[model samples]
Target: MTPLEILSTTATGLGAGLALIIAIGAQNAFVLRQGLRGEHVGLVVLVCMLSDIVLIAAGIFGIGEVVQAVPAVVVVIRLAGAAFLLSYAALATKRAFRPGALNASAQQGSLNRKVVLATVLTLTWLNPHVYLDTVLLLGTLANQHGDLRWWFGAGAAMGSVIWFSALGFGAKLLRPVFAKPGAWRVLDGLIAVVMVVLGVKMALGI
Candidate 1:
């Protein structure tokens, strides 16, 4: 591909990636929470970006075809993700009912690093939508660029990195607002609603 073609392909990939990820979902919710709490925010961002890169690469390598071939894989992932989301929603609901202190240090100490990392991985990897966006959709779009597919994937990966970094770091600006217990309660309530709604939708295949 010529330089101009490459740039155009990469830009398309970037826009597509941003469009896919910049939505209200479990992954973004968790990242936002971590950012607001100032706990392992960098780690969360890194995991999300890396996971996207791997999935995007797999798509560029034609794993999307395999995924499309096995419909059961998507179903299983959807069910698992749905269960996780529902459980998390329950937890969020409980938190909303009795939100404890909103101090970052107070809550941050309760979450262990390993647990945070595991949660990040689960949120990123277990969602069927992630596969749809990064693997199936983006992969198919990248292939339209022919030999420039890898470049497209690279651009998508860059988009993921930019988004996660911005989300994880930018949420800190809300620290002052979230410092109040009421703010945390409201946030948790919203999270619970989002989680439950998404979970139900996934379970029903709607």
Candidate 2:
């Protein structure tokens, strides 16, 4: 591909990837919460970025087609993801109702690093929509670029890195607001709602 063609394809991939990822969902909520809490923000962002890269690469390599051909696998993932989201939603609701002191500087009652890492991983990998959006949709779109598909994938990966980094790090600016316990309650409540809605949608395969 010529230089102009490469730039065009890459920019198209970047925009497409960002459009799908910028939607409000369980994963983004979790990342935002973690960023607000100032707890393992780097790890959370890294996991999300890496996960997106891997998924986008898989799509470029045609694994998306294999996944689509297996309806049973998708069903299993959907049910499991729904269950996990609902369970997390319950926890978020409990937190909303019984919020602890939320001092950003104090970092009081921070969750363990391992727990945070696992939760982020589950949120990223377990969601069926992630597969559909990153693998199937983006993959199909990238393939349409033919010889420039890898460049498209690279651009998508770059978008993931940019977005997650901004979200995870830029959240610090809102630390003063979230310092209030009431803010924590509201944030957790919203998270719970998002999680519940996503879980229900996944469960119903909607």
- Would you estimate the TM-scores of all the predictions? 0.95, 0.95
RMSD of each: 1.4, 1.6
- Overall local distance difference test of candidate 2: 0.88
Off by over 4 Å in 1: 99-106
Tell me the tens digit of each residue's lDDT in model 1 across 1-206: 68998898889889999999999999999999999989899999999999999999899888999988998999999999899989999988987775363443455556889999988898888899888878999999999888899889988998999999999999999888887657877888899999999999989877
lDDT by residue (1-206, candidate 2, tens digit) is 69999999999989998999989988889888888878899999999999999999999889899888997888989999999999999998887775352433444446999999999999999899888889999999999999999999988998999999999988989988887657877787898999999999999999
Q: Against the unseen true structure, what C-alpha lDDT does each candidate score?
A: 0.88, 0.88
User: Per model, how many backbone clashes are there?
Assistant: 0, 0
The TM-score between candidate 1 and the true structure equals 0.95
